[model samples]
Target: MKISEELKYTSEHEWAKIDGKAATVGITDYAQDQLGDVVFVELPEVGQMLKQKDEFGVVESVKSVSSLYAPLSGKVTAVNEKLKDNPSIINKDPYGEGWIIKLELPGLEEATHLLSADQYLKALGL
Candidate 1:
């Protein structure tokens, strides 16, 4: 499993890539593998407010449906509409075209609660 050092991770397997106040969120490589082949995604609406550690959406796989969680609190700015038709992109390129949402983080303080890639790998016993 590849975990990029540039991204922050949540215990729920969500990953966030911070870019100033804006952030792009997605499930990690480990998550996609665990979920098996992704068949569909139920993305949160743009402009919806989400709390840190809260369920924001769902990723349905051939095996089971899994909820996608927010790594930090914020208002959703955009959702990747491409996922509706190409959910398998998550399994093919989870950190790129597979990104699920973009959020305007409430504050930088919330970022402190997230884990570094190294820490995240340790948490998973990698």
Candidate 2:
């Protein structure tokens, strides 16, 4: 499982890469691995408001369908439309091209609640 040191993680297995007031969010590598081969992604529309821990979307894989949660409260600035046609990119590169959404954070301080890469690894007992 690849955990990004530059990103913050949630216990639910989402990751946030905060850049100023903007944050790019995605399911973690461990999450994709657990879900098996992704077949479809249901993403929230751009400009949608989301609260911390809210269900933002769903990822449907061969193994199961799982909810994708918001890692922080924010308005979605963008969605990864490419995933609609090729959802498997999430399994190929979850933290990069497979990022789900970009959010306009209400406050950067909300990131404090997120775990670091090491902390996430420890949480998974990896």
Candidates in order: C-alpha RMSD to true structure: 0.7, 0.6
In lDDT terms, which candidate is top?
2
Tens digit of lDDT per residue, candidate 2, span 30-88?
Answer: 99999999999999989899999999999999979999999999999999999999999
Residue 41 of model 2 has an lDDT of 97
Clashing residue pair totals per candidate (backbone < 3 A): 0, 0
- What's the true lDDT of residue 98 in model 2? 97
Residue-wise C-alpha lDDT for candidate 1, range 47-97, written one tens digit per residue: 999998889999999999999889989999999999999899999999888
Native-vs-model 2 lDDT? 0.95
Ten contiguous residues with the weakest lDDT in model 1: 105-114
For model 2, the superposed segments whose C-alpha errors exceed 4 Å read none
lDDT over C-alpha atoms for residue 88 of model 2: 98
Cα-based lDDT at residue 18, candidate 1: 97
What is the total number of backbone clashes in candidate 1? Answer: 0
